[model samples]
Target chain A: MIVLVDYKAGNLTSVQLALAEVGHESVISSDPSVISAADRLVFPGVGAAGSAMEEVNRLGLAPVLKDFVATGKPFLGICVGCQIILDWSLEDGRTACLGLIPGGTEIFTPGPGSKVPHMGWNHVGFYRPHPLFEGIPDRSHFYYVHSYYPTPSDHADVLAESDYAGVRFAAILGRKNLAAVQFHVEKSGAHGLRLLKNFCAWDGGC
Target chain B: MLTKRVIVCLDVRNGKVTKGVKFAGNVDLGDPVEMGAQYYRDGVDELVFYDIMASAEKRPIDIAMVRAVARKVFIPFSVGGGIRNLEDMREVLLAGAEKVSVNSLAVQNPDIISQGARAFGKQCIVLGMDAKRSDAPGLPSGYEVYVQGGRKAMGIDAVDWARRAVSLGAGEICVNSIDADGTKSGYELKLTRLIADAVEVPVIASGGAGTPAHLVDVFREGRADAGLVASMVHYGTYSLPSIKSALATAGIPVRSVP
Candidate 1:
């Protein structure tokens, strides 16, 4: 069964329901054994990086997440859950993250006539071929609700890119057994559901 | 680039959608689940269900409807009305709604905004303000905040309240004009622009959405990030795709319909 890590972060329900829609039965858990034993891990989060990190550490699931990644298990993170895997985040005035990705996250300081939070649907341009994007079109629009985005040190880690306020950021990222998206795939429509189904069948070999 | 959002608002009273909403396949209408699924399939960026039931028993029925919609529809949708505190917000979100909007209760207790934002993150808290044109003393924008579903006017400046709500961590602001609600003549551009300019958060222009041209005006002139509609789509006056196509033709960036 797919194990969805529970760290008291939001969007767990939507993620679970989306998985169900894709014909997958997943269990939400913070238990170490359940998370580590599962074939795949779906880490979904919303809210500030500081508190989200605190919850991960509080539940003692941080180390478990690290070990799961190290084992080359299929894993995915969404939204802030995706951000927390980065080295650091500028949200809440700089919060330390899981450091799985070698870079940090920065808040969007858009030019004039740009709204912060970077909320709404925007196009995602694929940079590299991956199974996660099996049938999805290039530059397809997905729902986004975030003020900060990850700045991966290695450009090769970037799977897809999206522009906001003239600044193009990494909308989808992948490294070995892990894939994470800055957009809320659960909230996104058909394309999102397709992406989730692809991930469900992913074997951690990008 | 964040394209402008076209949202369909549904008013649910006692498990029944109170407005005109036709299902494409079925002849019968007013089913919230069918209408919501139809709108989502028609390319609406988002959906909002406002709980207007006054009875306690009907509240659970609304929650059930939210669950049903979440099961079939795969887009983001928000729930509002009768949400008094964080628990209520949690109930709606847990029931599968993405955001919980607070209007009259927010005006009564301002802390709920900050509290909800703190608990569920700012993205989940939406400030729904019903504003009316006012030239009363001390009213700067000539728009006063209205509460109790537009029955009572609080002398509070509309723009100021929006700013405060954002500062208190409101992720989005929905400015509904009491005067233009059902008139469909046009949106209250003045009020929409005032609040849209005041807050950095995304602002939705609601109340009067007569034609696709009105949405174009709000997106360009009013600077609204999103436009909310009910009567036009509900009454079958405009299909969701046609409205989006109109916005795109007018040179305004909008999500392409499916």
Candidate 2:
């Protein structure tokens, strides 16, 4: 069963229903044991970086998540979940992150006439081939609502990219057994469901 | 690049959508959840549900309804009306709302905007202003702010209040023109431009939208970030695909429905 990590953040029902739409039955739990034993793990969040990390640590699921990644298990993070996996974030101020990936997050300071919270559907450009994105067309649009994005030290981790306010930040990332997308795949309509299906069938070694 | 958004607003009362003209005469629409899901399927960029009866009942937000709609719709959903404190905001967000819009409660307690932003990031808070043109002079167009579904006027300058709300940590603002609502003439362009220029955040122009060209004018002439419509969409006067195509043809950067 797919395990959805709930940290008292934003909506999880949509994620649950989206999975169900794809004929997948997942359980929402913050329990480390269930997450560790699941076939795949999904971390979905929509909020600040500091508060989300605090909840992860409070539930003592941080170490469990690290072990899950170390085990080469399939894992995915969405929006704020993707940001928390970075080394740190500079939102309200500088704050530490999950350290799963080597990099830090920065707020998207758009140029003149560009909106801050890049909230809308934008096209995603594939950078490298990955099984998680199988059958998903290049330049396919996905729903996004965020002010901050991650900047990894290694360019090899990027799986896809999207442009907003003249800045092209990383939209999807994957290295070994772990993978995550900055956009809300659950909210991206049919293409989103196809992406989820691809992830569920992916072998972690890729 | 920022794309122009087309939104559908639902006046949800007791879990059912009730449509009216100038917020006076009421007519029952269909179920809120079913209508919300229909809009989502039709490729609406976002959905906003305003709880018009929460304050009259003196209860918290209708979280169950919010959850019901959120569970079915994949796009972003925002809930407004009767949100007074952080607890109320938390309940709505937990119930699947991406953002919480404050109307009457926000006017009564402006500090609640800051408090809500501090507790649950700024992007989750939207300040909704109901505006109407006044006959009095000394004010440009005599813009007066209204609250409680535009039934009462607050006598406050709409421009000044919009500036204050942005300063108090409102991430976005929705200017709903009560005079032009249900008229379908077009958006109050002058008022829309005034507020859009007054604040730094994205401003949504609500009310008086009949045709897709009107939406194009609001985005170009009024310089609004988004446009909100109700009757025209509900009554089947326009389809989402055709409207988006018209906006794209007009050189407005709008996401086409796939």
Winning candidate number (DockQ): 1
lDDT of 2 by residue, B1-258 (tens): 457889999998877888788887878798989999998888888899998988878787778888788778877789988786889898888777778999888898999999988887777889999999987664564799898889888878899888899889888999999998888899999899889887778889999999998999999888888899888888888988888998999999887676
| A123: Cα error in model 1, Å | 0.6
Per residue, candidate 2 scores C-alpha lDDT tens digits across A133-168 of: 788788888888889988988999888999887789
Candidate 1 residue B243 Cα shift, in angstroms, is 1.2
Q: Write the per-residue lDDT of candidate 1 for residues A105-197, one digit (tens) a residue.
A: 988885557888898999899999999999998888899999999899999899999999778999988999999999999989999999999
Query: What TM-score did chain B of candidate 2 earn?
Result: 0.97
- lDDT (C-alpha) at residue A157 in model 1: 90
Best by TM-score: 1
Give model 2's DockQ, 2 decimals: 0.52
Clashing pairs in 1: none
lDDT of 1 by residue, B89-164 (tens): 8888888888999898899899999999999999999999989898798889999998876778899999999999
